[model samples]
Target: MVLRVNGLFGWVRANDRRSIALFGGLILAINVGAALFLLLPLLAVDPDHAPVTAWGGYARRYVPLVTLAAGAVFALHLMRHVRSVQRLTGFAFVDDADEPRLCRLVEPLAIGMGLPAPYVGVIEARALNAFACGLGRRDAVVVVTRGLIDALDDEELAAVLAHELAHIVNGDIRLLAAADAGLRLVGWLARPPAARRQQVGALLSLPVIMAVLPPLFVFILIAGICGQAAIRGSRLIRLMISSSREFIADACAVEATQNPAALVSALRRIDGRSRLNHLPPGQDAMMIDGASEGGFATHPTIARRIAVIVAVTGSMALNAPKRRDTRSPDQRDRAACAIRTGVFGAAPPASERGTPDLVDPGDARNWLGFTPVMTLGAVLAVAVFLGMHRHDLHRPAALAAALDPRPAGILLAVVGREFVCNAAFSSVGLALRATGLDRPVGCDAAPARDLAAAQTSGSVGRFLAALTEPPAGLSMHPNGTFGSAPSPATEAETVRTRRCFRTKGYARGDGGLHAVDAPPRRDGAFDIGRWLAGAEAQAVQTAAAGPEAGDRPLDDYLSSRKSIVHAVDRYFGEPGLAMMRRSFASPSHQRAIGRLRERLGDPRWAAGLPPVRRAEFTLLANSPEDFVTCSARDRMDRKATVPPT
Candidate 1:
């Protein structure tokens, strides 16, 4: 337990350090930029301001002083009323006398985390959720809903409390509150009605804010409304900070409790329940759960988090079956049903329902490492690209001077196509050649125009065909009107002369990239407005899980993970998955993958593979030099077919 706790703590610290380092660097850069912004405006205020030519000296003297002064003031007021927001939203302070057990639970945990006890608050929410916030451990507040208190068992409750306490000890609670407030204010001011009026007010008040408060507050305000990108960027950064924070906090909780099972149990129970809470944007992050599987998400998926916990603990950690809930059984059942529908939505036809776990998916992951495309397609792409667009590349002034005569857009589009295609092909070729493996890479879908093109042409072929051909009009292609395939392959069955790899999700029986006419499940009865609405909310209805259904609702939901493509993207994003794939590509990777695939039986391959996956990642990490580039003579000299470039 001690060793597990220490390891989990170390993981927590590492993720915290990485995420915080990035957040800190961004904050420092923004502050420095803010100081420079204030300089010119401040100079204008000076009665005897330095002339434009001699302003360097003035800036050097004034910038640092103003920056420091403003930052100090902003730090104080930024998170001042954070707790009040929750209180005003109807959370009541918990009296120790009234809730001795809850207070008692927090005290020991706070002591373990080396922090003063946090204030506890309770919301009347029926949803099971809780979060922590404060300037630091000393004044931290852990807020829970009445439902959460009622729902979680003692161990689960302790786990939840420990998690929130972990947030306080981490010193992220306060920073999160400040950032959320800053970002929310920006979003509010960016809307049209607040446009010039808000801008004028902020600018006019800058002098007073700089003089009395911290210039940091002014900086944050300015950065918030800098532009749409700035506002969005801030929100994204904040969300990332929040996302990584949850993982660290979970680890910290495990360490504090020395029980990963409790946390996992709590997470699973709370996962779908929290959706019904009327949480504010900022508060949603602090909660046990919300929309955890999207781009602008606050937390990683509940299953992923649980898997991570299992990885950290090296234990099954699946709680002994819970003494199921009794009161409001119908309500619980309905919540579960809604969650199943919302998270998984409807399954596509059996043909489209299952995507295999391949070494690579859809040639989308590493565009440059694919072997089949690179060796055969890259040289051709370069020739075609230059031949078709060399005139435009040579014409420097054409963009500004040419009055729509040169077909510049067409030329640029083709160049982009060539560049993208070759990059994909090159990546494939590099991976194969590096691994000393000569394999074919082509889609196995029936020969539709695009599928045919995909099979024979470079990665660009499929992409271009999807855009221009029938059914799957992925996007508008310039090739439809302007030019033809420079080296078109006949629309015939692309034979698998070489070894073709399967991506995990898209691996069909034939093992090809284009298994369908269109990209996954976006086929059949597509309605513009309803589709958009459903995109935001997967409100598909599901019949009650019964004997005939022969499926666990939760399992179905987990299997059909929300935002399928986004989920796939995450697997690609992980270093562990990449390492595992790279290892599978070369003999070492390939052999390791073979053993691994045999061990991991079919069905439910995507989920809960984290433990073994992490072990493989560990193996790779330990012997990194062995896998770095598959040294031609290091050990496999006898079998080195193609040297790694």
Candidate 2:
């Protein structure tokens, strides 16, 4: 027995060291990964943007600082979580005055183990469970549910107290507390951005949406990936910390009490009844019997624990457990249905029975009892919203100016610049400054130049001109309207004009002119409202002109609207541009476009067009509303086709 005990002690020592190392390594990896994630976008954009020395310096300065900060935060969070657990479990520290029997049971066990008597507490729960928690020996606490005390005999109760005392003596309490804290910290950090959904939805202004969404989405994606990794890593660490400690504690309990039979009996009584349904998840590691059972279970099964105890102690009682409850059905049902009424005449409602009143009255859920932490989160959210909207807030005049189309366009351009060029440079600059590598770069001037060019260029006017002008192969009729097909001479001119337009950056699908002089603003900056308004006006005018004018007026207006839609597409770098080009090159699209032009030129050619030609023409003749609706539908269709980052 002595040899077996010594071997278990040795194993415990080695496993403890391994658990600590794994936990520290996981934290270090997380800190390093965070730093790298921050720098990833910059590196992806321009690999040679920063020097090797700069990166090395960044690691040397910030990695340690970040690790230290993380440690400090974890420590604070762990302490707070410990207190929260105590509160949530409705356990209060007791003395000889509050519970003479419980204190008397634990004090002797502590003395026998050559450890200070840890504080004793009682949970109001009727569940048969117990757990030990603390930072260290001095502040350690052992808590038992009332159900446990009432269910077990004096010997069995002493064995359970001895088991908890073993945890304190072996320093398992501290490790368990740390594991609990880590699991919660990772979960809270990695939680999806549901709180910000309302804020994002409230951003009705186009400029605000444009300015905020890119960075916000980037943050969410990176946080989501890192959060999942952290959560998994924390769980693995908790499992490692907990897996062996329970066995060692169980073994120690038998050794301390010198009565393996008592523990075996206690285990048998407690096995299925130990799970506390009111207690939150992730507390399984600390409980006498885990609240859950799975492959990833923190505690060894009760049967496995009994077998080990028997092997080490050679206790015949453990191997001979064939006892069964002999109570009558009525008596058993009454015992099972018993509820603690405290000092009251009858038990409160089921929902209000077990848990204690939370420190915060506003906290309706026991799980979210950390009111101060929630307040801090709310403050952080407000700060982020304010930071993102600083541009709009500081320049209220710009928002009012947006009512005018030209200012609105310019304001959009500015926001786009901030989103794309300025934000990138700012992030890089902050990183460089942190690393003491803040040297002036030529790239600093690029955004300013782009903003200036956008402000000066008559791109909107050129866009409108491109939309209103008729495409080649169409001729003017005697009524001063364009609705006639070209002559043979004009057909050759038409092909030449089409070839020239294609070379000048016109998409064949809609004959929309792309701005070649100015670089395409990939940051969605177009004035959508202005375009929609123009389309609506054109639709009204076409309606007033009536069917007497044939489809000539309708065709002209639709074609113009399509041109503007494609121009916006071009501005946003035309997602799926390659697919669009391939489609336009197909023989089917060619025939469809030819038939569409004929139908536009002669309203009476056919009362209705074929589905293929109609669909193709619809693509080229949609108003702003139709364009938006189609774009949304197409995006949904192509959602699966988009590659994962």
Candidate 3:
């Protein structure tokens, strides 16, 4: 048993060094990658530039300067609140004066371990958990939740305190603190751009909107990708710290206390209740029992820890406390209040506690969060500069054109315009429909001769016209005929119906009566309306062309026809109607659409059309099937009778 424990201790020490080295390497790699990304433009412009050549010289003059600056910033930030356990957990430090019993238990354990009597704090949470955190012995603090204190007997509590003291002695606190610092640094780097300053008036300034949006999107995209990488790196560092340290600490606690049974009993008591929800991800390693159990878990399962302890101690039966401490409410409050005031009398003198090397308040806020406007402006300036000097660099003309700021800006503007215009059209149409103002027009009878003439045009042509030409509020009749009607007042509603019709199986040709295909329903139930509609269309087709006209099977024909309905029943029956409504109701979409309309070169494109007509055109233009439905075959077939304006 002694041999095994000694072997484990040696293994843990070596692993700890490797973990630290791995973390240092991760930081170096990240810094190097960032430096390269920032200097890419310079390197691309002239690899032989004097400053670049000198920086890349054998001695590497600039590397140390960059390293020093980064290290200094990191160290300063970490030290600013080194003793912040109380601040983070909202637990006040307790000394012997506050709770002599609790402090007495911890003090003897610290003395036995040959370490300073660290600060002891108690959380008000009901979860049974305890953790030790600090840079080293002098500043170390042990925090236990109220639940843990009330659950365990004196022997069990002493064993738990010994385990935490072992962490301080083993320097595990410093290692965990470094991992936490790395995580915080990554979070600081990846934070989103601050909100833009608002204008005084009700209306927003167009110039400001245009200037902010593209850069905002670019920053988000770039920062999101980089942030993910940093997060993964931090996770890797924690994994490197390994769960072996937990075993080592457990072994040391048993050695110091010489009571393996008490430690095992403490483990049993804390088995399922040691998780602290308020603690962040990387800090789980500091807990006696981590928040989770898996391959990635920072601590071994409670059962495994106990088994190992029993095996090492060669003990079979263990005695543990069954009942919790039954202290009254007044007693608990007195204990809490005593701890809260203990620090005031016991705190070190100002002169003895050296000034913290904290980052400047103004610089910390501005730099860590990132000044979006200024940062974006600088990026744009660099891009513009590179574009202008691309030809002189003797690079490919294509590369220079790609780098040109004008094309990028124009592309973003055009996309933003289209998005905004579509949103506006959808929003206004929905508002009109919701208020019962824009009602759909009733079907008006059209000449049978006109319907025949329209059908005579190529099927492909009819299909294209239905898609490309704006919705004319045309209705399909029961008698296999068409009727012209006034454009619906609720254009979005009508457009949505038409869209649903196409999606269900109605094809553009054959006066929108033929069903090309029927999509399978998720519920696996046959649609009766679709089936009936298919039978009616099939009968009409059979009558027009004799029984043996087409060789297609009857089942296939019926299946296709099953989805083509003449009424708005098909639209209302759709499952995605509510989702569609919510999407159109989105304010961002509306704002984008408005911006798009304002940026268009030709006012007549949208402004000349009535609101309803404008919405119909916008809906058609933005439909996913527009390209395929409005094909050249349909556009060129001009013989089809057009709907009356």
- Give the number of the best model, judged by TM-score: 2
Worst 10 residues of 3 by lDDT: 356-365
Q: Write one digit per residue (lDDT tens) for candidate 3, span 330-382.
A: 65665455445431112223343333332111122133233445445445544
lDDT of 3 at 477: 35
TM-score per candidate: 0.42, 0.49, 0.44
Stretches off by above 4 angstroms in model 3 are 1-7, 29-62, 190-226, 293-297, 316-645
Candidate 2's residue-wise lDDT over 71-147, tens digit each?
Answer: 78668856665576665676767899987767878898889898888888887665678888877788788898767
Each model's Cα RMSD: 36.1, 25.2, 26.4
Off by over 4 Å in 1: 1-7, 32-62, 87-89, 181-226, 276-278, 293-296, 319-645
> Which residue pairs clash in candidate 2?
none
Ranking by lDDT: 2, 3, 1
Error of 2 at 324 (Å): 20
Predict model 2's lDDT versus the native.
0.55
